[model samples]
Target: SGGPNYKVALGRRDGLSYATEEAVLSFLPSPTSNVTALIDVFTELDLTTKDLVTLSGAHTIGIAHCSSFENRLFPTQDSTLDPIFAENLYLTCPVINISSTTVIDIRTPNTFDNKYYVDLLHREGLFTSDQGLYEDFRTKPFVIIFALCQHLFFENFVYSMTKMGQLSVLTGSQGEIRRNCSALNSNLSWYAVDGDGHDGKVF
Candidate 1:
């Protein structure tokens, strides 16, 4: 069987510097960000609404901090939630004053899976960003599509990722690839090598 064709592009440079804290706070999407907010962010980069829905599938991986969605657990939750789902999330993300340790994506917290959409149907989506995708009429259909078909979800996710990668990027000539992501320029930094080398670092 023939696999997808591949090509190499050279001269991709690393950015001299990453976004600052203020820059991140100003531009990074927040859990409380609504559909309009998401649209604005995507528009800034010329991404379409379809790309937005497809890229939003990134929620399939990673966990949301409890602080991001504690409101759903307290006061009242969306009536669409199954009782068992509500209780399960409540147990995993109890309302507490802890710094930032609780997680909301209970099922397959670290893996990329369609469970994120399943969580949405149950009103258990961890982030307002995640839940907002389902609430927005423009993206809801794609959300349902992703929920039902894992293969389709993966295909769209890859497309979205490809589009996202087209956004402004830093070239290696502009910056050095930090051996340690956590400690950007620490020469004494001890780096841990995983099975995939540098692939596991979040940023």
Candidate 2:
């Protein structure tokens, strides 16, 4: 499939750093976070507001475990959530700690499309972080632009994904590879994208 491209640089080392619970919480944004908080997390990774909204389109085909959005149902539902949408989610999630899941996109849960942004425009966003895009003036335009045209969303998503994949990456034996390098590789499929230099290149 010919599209906006990013190069693949192989043999990069993976980081093994692990921090304490407090430190971990300091960086991870909550599902209920607002635009400001969500943008803060993206900025930490050099992602832009446009990238945040465009990448959010992935939710079109996404699913979330009950634990992920259960809080919205319990402890009084979130005011921003559409009442009809929340009611349906309650039926799916039912009681606290019940094991279940729900789709992010109400219109089409299995397509890579713009319906996620469309849902946000109707205040039907599943997560606070998602709805924050429409509620905040700074990011609302990107949501409208993507919702109106999926091709635009796809183009921006490719660039954003390529950018994210290159963050602090270590190439050319700069770090250690703890696992087997290639002994068991014959069991897996392999592919390589031959390409010229690009800012999106990742290992």
Candidate 3:
């Protein structure tokens, strides 16, 4: 759980408008994306290859739904996925649409660390986008460096995350600051849950 501490500049203004689902999907890399696609998406945001791999370390702390990686398991296994890890994934997700989840980082899932890079080295990365880091020449070096030296990973992560925070940022008087960060100041009901109460969909 312990990780690097970096100073983040304060008083960053919140956006008045929320991103549309289509806009978000268009900009972000997909779970099954290759390193090239990842690089392209990040580059469009003015992020470098180093930023791509560094920011990817955030995967060390989240859980991914089985649906995100089922393609690599069903039909044919991804050659990059470790056999033992693949078997365990099969146990959790025997078939597609099973509605299960697993930690993104097989090792140190709760920690913000370079273990995600280590996972890539072992071919245990949960997503194609992740494993593809090791498969690509551009990103593989950063992966190896992060795997071997966690301090460098932490240092780079802080820089990349800070750089990312500056992108598309709204400046003074450009946007309103809502009392509740989740919703607009005028509309408290930012999202609606279906009858099943499973997920909140943004309007």
Give the top-scoring candidate (TM-score).
3
Model 3: per-residue Cα lDDT over 1-203, one tens digit each? 87889998776677778989998788878999999888898889999999999999999899999999999998999999999999999999999898999999989989888899999999999999999999999999999999999999988889998999899887766876555777775576665546774445567
The alpha-carbon RMSD values of the candidates against the true structure, listed in the order shown, are: 7.9, 7.6, 8.1
Q: Which regions of candidate 3 deviate over 4 angstroms?
A: 186-203
Candidate 1 structure quality by residue, lDDT tens digits, 94-119:
66443454444567667777777877
> Looking at candidate 1, what is the lDDT of residue 116?
78
* Rank ordering of all candidates by lDDT, starting from the highest: 3, 2, 1
lDDT-wise, the better of 2 and 3 is 3
Q: Deviation in angstroms for 75 in model 3?
A: 0.6
Candidates in order have lDDT scores of 0.68, 0.78, 0.89
Q: Report the error of model 1 at residue 134, Å.
A: 1.5
- Mark the 10 consecutive residues where model 2 has the least summed lDDT: 184-193
| Residue 44 shift from truth in candidate 1, angstroms | 1.2
Encode model 2's per-residue lDDT on 25-77: one tens digit a residue: 87678887889988988998888989888877778887888887777788898
Overall local distance difference test of candidate 1: 0.68
Highest-scoring model, lDDT: 3
What TM-score do all the candidates reach, one by one?
Answer: 0.71, 0.75, 0.86
